[model samples]
Target: MGDIRRRWTVTARARSDRGPNGLSLLPWLLMGMGALSHLIQGDAPNPVIGGLGLFTFNTLYIAIVVRAFSPCHRETPLTWGLLTALAALTFALAIGYGREWLLLFPLLGLAVGAVVRRRKRLGRITVPLVLAVGVVTFWRDGWNSFGVVYGTFISVMVTAAILALDETVRQLRATREELARTAVEKERLRFSRDLHDLLGHTLSVVVVKSEAARRLAPHDIDAALAQVADIESVGRQALTEIREAVTGYREGSLATELDRARDALSSGGIEPVVRQSGPPLEPRTEALLSWVVRESATNTLRHSGATRCEIKVGGTPERVRLTVTDNGRGGDAATAGSGLKGLRERVAAAGGTLDSGPAPRGGFRVTAELPVETQASQEWETTG
Candidate 1:
C-alpha cells in the first residue's frame, strides 16, 4: 500500500509539472486509429503508398504539436513549414480515403490552434481552413460529414482560449512577485533614511553639548552641570526616537525639531533665528519639514563656520515653503551629502521639491516646498 501511494503521488506531481505541453495533445492521435485499421485490414487501395503517407502524416503531427508548446519555437518558419506540410498530407489522405481518414481534419485544427496565439491571426488561418474542410467533406462524404467541420472549429477555438488564459495567469504571477520585491526595497530605503537623519542630528547635538560642558567645567561648575544635564536629556530622547525608528513608527514634529535646533545652535556658539508664519500645517507636512530642519541645523553646526543661521517657514493653506540660510563661507549643506540626497528623494516621493546650494549673498542655503495635501499624506492620515 505504501509503494502504491508513493507511485500515485509521483504521478500526480509529474502531471502538474508538465503543465500545458505536447503530451496533452498526444491522446488525440488515437483518432487516427481508424485509418490505421484500414491499412491493417488491407482495404486501402495503394497499401505501400497509404502506409508511407500515414507514417509521414503522423511524423509531421508530432513535430508541430511538440514545437507548439515552446514559445520560442512555436512561431518559427520551421514550425509553420511543418504545419503547412502536415495540412497538405492531411488533405491528401482525407480526399483519397474519405471514410476513416476524414478525422485528420480536426487534428489539423488542433495543431493550427496550438501554434496561432493572437485571435485575429487565428481567425485569419482557421476560418478559411474550416471552409476548406466543409467543402472537402461535402465532396467526399456529403452533408453527413458536418460533424468533422464542427469538431474542427471547436478544436481550434477551445485550445486557443485555454492556452491564452494560462499564459495570462503566468504573466500575472510574475508581475505580482516583481511588485513584492519592489516594496521590500522601498521599505529598506525608508529605514536607512530615517536612521541617517535621526543619528546625524542626535550625535551632533551630543558632541556640541559635550564641548560646551568641557569648556565651562573650569570656570563654572553649575553651568557645566547644566550642560551635562541637557546632554542626559538629549540622550534619553534619542533612545526613545531610535526605538520608534526601529519599529518604523516614528513621526516628526516641526516644533520639537526647531527647539532642539535652537539648543544645538546655541551650544555651538552660533546665533539661531527661526520664524514661522502660515495656516496650521498638516502633520505630514510638519514631519517632512522637521527632517529638513534637523538636517539643515546639523550641517550648519558642523560645516558652516557661520556665527548666525536663519530658518524660516511660510506659505499659504495650499502650499508650504521652508528656507535655511547661514552666513558662514557657504559650502556645506549644498554639497552632495547622503543626508541631503536621501532627504531629497523622500521629499520628492511626497510630491515636493528641495533645493540646496550657495545663497546669493554669501552663505549656504537649503529650501523646500510642498503642497498642503498629498496622496501619500492622505493615506497615512487615513490609516493612522
Candidate 2:
C-alpha cells in the first residue's frame, strides 16, 4: 500500500519520454498552434492573451508527462497509455479555446488520493508548485479572465481529491493482506497437529499387530490370520480418519479410541479394564481425551510387556482427567521414547499437562489433566 501511494506521488512530478499519444495529441496540437501565434506576434502582445497562452502551456506539458507515466498496478499499460492520449486532446482544447479549465478534474482526483495516503510532504510540494504557476498566470491576466479563474479552481480541487483517495486505497489493501496471512498460519498449525496424531497412532498399531501375527503363526494358523485381518482393517480405518482430518469435516469420538485400544490389548493377551465417570463431555473435550487414550493404548500394545492394564477417565465441572496404567515387567525405555514425547506435545497444545513414568506400586502410569474445557462447558450452561 505504501508502494501504491508512492507511485501516484512520484507520478505527479515525473516526466514522460514519448510524445503524447491518442487523445493527448489534440492538446499538444492546439498548444503548438497558439505558441505559433505567440511567436509570430511577439512584438505587440496583450497581457490577457499571453497569460491565457501560458496557462495552456501548463495543461499541455502536464498532460504529456502524466500520460507517459504508467503504473503497472492495474489493467494493460495500453489502457493507461490511451488515457494519456485522451488527456493530450483535452490539453489541445485548452490552448485553442480556453478549455484548459477541464484539466482541473483529474488533478483534483490525484491530489485527493495523495492526501488520504498521509503524504503531507508530497501535498505540500505539489500544492505550491501548481498554485505558484496558476497564481502568476491569474495575476498576468488581471484576475477577471474566465480561463484563469476556472483553471486555478479546477487544478486545486482535483489535486486534493487524488491525494486523499490514494491514501485510503493503500490502507485498505494492507489490512486485507494481513488478514490473509493470519488465516494461512492458523490452517498450517491445524494440519501439522492432525498429521502428527494420525501417523503416530496408526504406526504404533501396525507394529503391535505385526508382532501378534508373528507370534501366533507357528502354533495357531487361524489366530495368525485373524491378527493379520485386524491389522488390515485398522489400517484402512486410520487412512479414512486421516482424510477426514485434512478436510476438517469430522469430529472424532473418544469411544472409538478406547475401542481400538481394547482390541489391541485383548489381542496381545493383556486384560484391559476401563472406568469412565462424570457427566457427558462437550464434543471438543471428548475428542481430545479420546486422542490421549488412543496414544496411550497404542504405546502399551507396541512397547509394554504388561499383562494387566487399567484405564480410568473421570472429571468434575472444572476439570477432566485420563489415566492409563499397566502392570507389566516395567522398563525405562517407554518413558524415554518418541511416542510419549509426541503425546506430551499434543497434550500441551490442548491446554493440558501429561505425566508419564513408572508407578511405585507395580508397572507404568500415564496421566493427563485438562482444566479449561470443563470450565468452558460450565460457563456455557450458566450463560444458557
Candidate 3:
C-alpha cells in the first residue's frame, strides 16, 4: 500500500512539473508577428504605445513555455495563471473597449484550465465563454474581420487537442497503478502460503514429539530431553528453510522448485501427488512451476485444513500444465487479497494462464498452464 501511494505521488509531481511542448509554437509565432507589426509600423504614440504593451504581453506568455519548464518555480500553475491573466488584460486594452476584447477572452481561460486539470464543468463553461464572447465581438461589429474568425477556429482546435492529450496521460497513469497493485498482492499471497508451509510441518512435528515425551518422561529423563531437543532442531531448521525458500523463489527454476516443494509439503503433512513426463524443462519455467507447487500446498494446509495435496506437473511439446488441488475450504479467489494477486502477476508475466477456484469435489483447485516454446516433455513423476 505504501508503495502504491508513493508511485502516485511521484506521478503527480512529475505531471505537475511538465511544460507545454513544441506543439504550441505555431500559434505563438502568428501572434508574435501581429504584435511586431502593430508596434513597429505607426508614427503616432497611441499606436506605438498599444503595440509595445501587447508585444510585452505576448513576450511574457511565450517566455512561460521555457520558464515554467525550468526547475525554478516560474513554471508553477499559479505563476502561469496570474501571468496569463495579465497578458489577456493587456491584449484586451490594445484591441479597444468593445467586442474586440471578447475576441481575446478565450486566452484568459488558460488560467482556469491550468489550475483545474480535470474539471469538466469548468471546461463546459469556458468553451461557451470563448465562443459566445468571440463570435459577438469578432463577427459582430463593423470592425469585425475574417482574420478574427480564422484565429478563433484555430484556437478552439488547439484547445481540444490539448484536452484530449491530458486525458490520455491520466488514463495511462491509472493503468500503470492498477498493474502495480496486482503485483504487490500476488507477492503477499506467495509469502503467506510459504510461511504456512514452513511453520505447519514444524508445529506438527513439535506436537508429536511433545506427546511422545509426555508419555516417556515418567520412565526416562533422557528420552524426554531428546524430544525437547527435536523441537529446537525443527524450529531452527524451519527458519533456515524459510530463508532459503525466499531466495530460491527469485531464481524461478522448475527443477529446483520441485525439490523444494517435495521437502516443504512433506514437513507440513501434505502428501504431494507429483507427475512428470519427457525431458528437462527450461530452467526458468521449472523454478516458477516449483513455486506454484510449494505455495499451493502451503495454502492447502493453512487455509483449507486439508490432509492431502495433489501436485501434477506435466507438459507437451507446446505447453506445460501444473495443477495443485486440495479437498479443503474452497472459495472465491477474490477473498485471496494480495497473495493471489501477486501469483496472478507472476503467472501473467511468464505468459501463463492461472485457473484457481473451488474444485467440484469440495476443495480448492489451482491450475496453471505455461507455454514451453522449446521441444521438451516432462514425464510423470510423484512425491509424497
Best by TM-score: 1
CA deviation > 4 Å runs, candidate 3: 1-249, 252-270, 332-337, 377-380
Flag regions of model 2 displaced more than 4 Å.
1-116, 119-193, 219-222, 269-271, 303-310, 325-384
**Residue-level lDDT for 138 in candidate 1:** 91
Q: lDDT by residue for model 3 over 1-384, one digit each (tens)?
A: 999999999999886645355245426344444445544665324765566556555555555443433335444776656565654564455355333333343343433333334446546645664555555555445446445545544454555457557657766887888899998876776676566545654565666567767877999989788878877876897787788667644444566556555644554556666666656777667766765665665566557766667777776778888888876678863224344555666779889988788888878888888888678444656565
Q: List the candidates' TM-scores in order.
A: 0.86, 0.53, 0.46
Backbone clash count for every predicted candidate, in the order shown: 0, 43, 24
Q: Report residue 31 deviation for candidate 2 (angstroms).
A: 11
Pick the winner on lDDT between candidates 1 and 3: 1
Worst 10 residues of 3 by lDDT: 108-117
Candidate whose lDDT is highest? 1
Ranking by TM-score: 1, 2, 3
* List of clashing residue pairs for candidate 1: none
* Least accurate 10 contiguous residues by lDDT in model 2: 375-384
